[model samples]
Target: MRAYERLLNYVKIHTASADDAECVPSTERQFDLARPLCDELKALGLTAEVDEHCYVRGWLPATPGREDAPCVAFIAHVDTVPDFPGEGVKPRVIENYDGGDLPLGESGRVLTVKAFPHLPKLARRTLIVSDGTTLLGADDKAGVAEVMTLLEELNEKKIPHGKVAVCFTPDEEVGRGTAFFDVLRLGADFGYTIDGGFEGEVVCENFNAAAATVSVEGFNVHPGEATGIMKNAALIAAEFAAALPADETPATTGGRKGFYHLTDLSGNVETATLRYILRDHDAGKLEEKKATFERLVASCNEKYGAGTVKVEIRDQYRNMKEKIDETPFVVDLALEATRECGVTPICDPIRGGTDGATLTRMGLPCPNLGTGGFGFHGPYEHITVEGMDAVVRILHAIVRRVSEMKK
Candidate 1:
């Protein structure tokens, strides 16, 4: 079966993860996709199972003469981002795209070439998009489909390759994808996360990330009695936001630039909370970003009261490049595989984090591979059928190259 076919079937199942959920999988609905994926892997003659945490793991032994080659693992996440509506995704398939502005079904949302300059390059290719109501789940689902198709091709064609391991993870959209991951058990020497955008992307570096929650406490008073004593928390929170560098934000920054993104803010006159995610490719710069938050909180407290403002900062993940550099072969092999498949290699640093970032730190040394997906995390999400096919071919090439490598 083709990779896009699998993506169409997988997107119909709602697997949007919740950010507020405290469970390992974050949502029980993730199991909806995990169970079937495990079953599919089992049917493919591989040992596969879905764990309690909704991680679907599978392994296929090396071909007869390739036993000495290093084991290679592939990973993809199952859950879509909770920030957008992820349920009821109705995908629209456009055969031979004309590279013009296309309107989504009835919702009045248009995918315009002017907005997305890459549309011209995708001309004449089959494109898949969602009805403007929800996300298409192609961010990682396309990756999942490509990996599945790779396995099927390797097995049916009797392709010579090393041991192939795969894991379909849950809650990746919520930053907890690897919280319960047991790296020692899956046991692949090195891996690739099939969770990236575009056809030829090979990502090794990503942002060092951290999340901050700034809480404000104020004295609420009647509007008529509002004087110097009344410190409105909402106003203070707004001030805090204004203090941030306007140019250093998700909207303004691009390509290796660090940013402070305010993801959520809620409060009243008495109390207000601001949640921000800080990201930078450099660990030192990330620490500086965190320190900026601390300084802001201190400045606010000094003006109001000693304990008027408080901040809680938590480190999410670090750049994987430090770990990936130790074993440069992982990236080198991916680039070689991409070139071997006639796809020009795009080795750009990821603007965001991936499951591979945490996995690489956990000793897996996994880099990221693209699944031909674009415009992720919203209704505008799209992918090309030809792009997914290219990824599957690249995966096969990577396996073949590994099989030919000396232990």
Candidate 2:
């Protein structure tokens, strides 16, 4: 099947990962995509295994005469973001885009160049986009399809290479894909996560991330008879969120600028809860951001009475720069592969976290490669057919180069 066909087929599976689920895979339905990947790997004569949580693992043996080379890994996540509806997707391939807006779905939805200027860049190129009624699921499934296609290509061509490990993870949308990943068991000298956007973009660094949850307790009394006795927990929760800097949010900042994102808030007059995500590229600033939240909570508790406000902050992942420093060749190989594919390489810090970020902390030294997608986690999500194929070529080149590095 073609790359676009693979993407279209994969999008039909609903793998929306949940942030609140306690399970490793978050949602069991993600296995719908993982199980079939295992079968495909086996068909290509690779050793494949699928776990209960939908984490699919495969090992492609070295080609003849390259058994002693250094092993490398290509990683992708099978889960899609839960921010949009991932079910009942209807994808259309616009062949030779004419720099005009393409209407999606029967709902009269259109992806206009006026809204996204990047649409015109793909003009005259084939692109697969959603019907505008639901998400296209290209966030990382595009990465999965590309990686699998490359593996099949290598196998069919009898390309000489070292051991290559493949891992299709779950819950990446909720930032937990790497939580249950067996890094050591997979056994690679280094790896790359093809889970980012843009064709030439290579991300070896990302923000230090943390999740903070604040709870407020208040006593409720009849408002008519208890004007002073009634405390509104929802108001207190609003105050806690308002204490953060106004300019730091996903909508307000870009390119290394970190911000506090208030993801959820709900409460009544008696109780309320506020959820926030803190991020920063600088370690010092990241710590400061967390400290600011704690200080705000402490101050609120003092005014609202002791134990009235509580804050729980959890560190999610740290910047991968230090980890990449220890394994510089990983980034180098990514750059080399991009140039070999005839794409201009652009090295930048990821404003958000990737599974590679957590894997780096786990001692894997994983960097992120791009899948040439844009408008991730939203309704305008799309992927260009040529961009997807070029990335596949890049992956193939990276694998061959890393094996050639082996003495």
Candidate 3:
């Protein structure tokens, strides 16, 4: 099957992962997508295994003499983000985009360049986009399809590739993709997560992440004649948000700049809860950001009484660059692969954390590559056919280059 056809097949399976869940796969539906992938890999003459938790592992053994070459792996998540609807995704292909607004959904919503400034660069390309109602599931599905197609090509041509390890992970959107991952069992020297955006992009640095939950208790009273008798929880929550640096959010900051992002806020007069996602590339600066959050929480509690507010902070992941720098050849292999594929490699810092970031910290030396996709985690998500093909070519080239590397 063609790469686009493979992506469309995967998109038909709803694998949206949730953050607030406690399950291993997070959602049972993820297996629906993963099972078929395991079968596909096995049918392609590769060794494949589908775990009970929806973790799919597959391997293409190196050609007889190529086994001594360095083992390189490729990974992509099976689950789409819960931020958008993954069910009933009506993906349509626009043959030769005109760089104009393309109407989506029955509600008359359109994918317009005026709204997404990056659309023009995709003009003249065959774009697979959603119908404005549901997400296209291109985030990592594109990556999955690209890898699968590359594997199929390598097998058919009987390419002399080093052992290629592949995995389809679950709950990446929920920040626990690598929680149950057994890296030692997979046994790859290094890997690449084909899970980011922008073709030709390589991400080796990502944010050190943390999550904070602030709970507030308020005295609910009758509004009339209440005077100073009532303390509003909602007001306190708003005050806490106001105290954060406005310019540090994802919208305002780019590159290595850190941010305190308030992801969710809810509750009323009697009780309120605010969730903040903290991020910074520098460990010290990341701690400083957390300290700032704690200090604000303390100040709020001191002003509102000891029992009025409660704050809980949890560390998520740390910077992977420190570990990645130890294996500089991994970066060179990717750059060399990009050049071989006739694309200029774009190496940049990741503003958001990824499974690769955590895996690298876990001693796998994994870096992130692009999915040839854009507008991820939303209904506007899309991937170009040309882009997917480019990624497949890049992957094939990267494997050959790594095989040629001096051990």
In lDDT terms, which candidate is top? 1
TM-score of 3: 0.91
Looking at model 3, residue 289 earns an lDDT score of 91
Ranking by TM-score: 1, 2, 3
List per-prediction Cα lDDT, in the order shown: 0.93, 0.88, 0.89
lDDT rank order: 1, 3, 2
TM-scores for the candidates: 0.92, 0.91, 0.91
User: Which digits, one per residue and each the tens of the lDDT, describe model 3 over residues 1-407?
Assistant: 67888998889889999989998799999999899999999999889998987899998898877778888989999998998789998889989988778877674777878778888888899999888888899988999999999999998988888889999999988878998888987888999999989889999888899999999999989999669888899999999899998898989988789998898999899999999899999999989998897788889889988778888999988888989999988988888888888988898887878899888988788999998998898888888999899999999999898777645
lDDT of 1 by residue, 161-252 (tens): 99989999999998899998888889899999999988779999999999999999989989889877799999999999999999999999
Estimate the lDDT of model 2. Answer: 0.88
| True-structure RMSD for candidate 2 | 2.4
RMSD of 1: 2.3
User: For residues 1-407, could you state the per-residue lDDT of candidate 2 as single tens digits?
Assistant: 55666898999989899989998888989999999999998998889999987889999998877888878888999988888898988888889988778887675878889887878888888888888888898888999999889888888887888899999999988878888899988898889998888888899989998999999998888888776777789989888888878898889999888999999999998999998899999989999998998899889988888898998999888999977898798899889889998999889887888888888889888999989988888768888999999898899889889778763
Predicted structure with the largest TM-score when compared to the true one: 1
Which regions of candidate 2 deviate over 4 angstroms? 18-20, 219-232
State the lDDT at 162 in candidate 3: 85
The regions of model 1 sitting more than 4 angstroms off are 83-88, 220-232
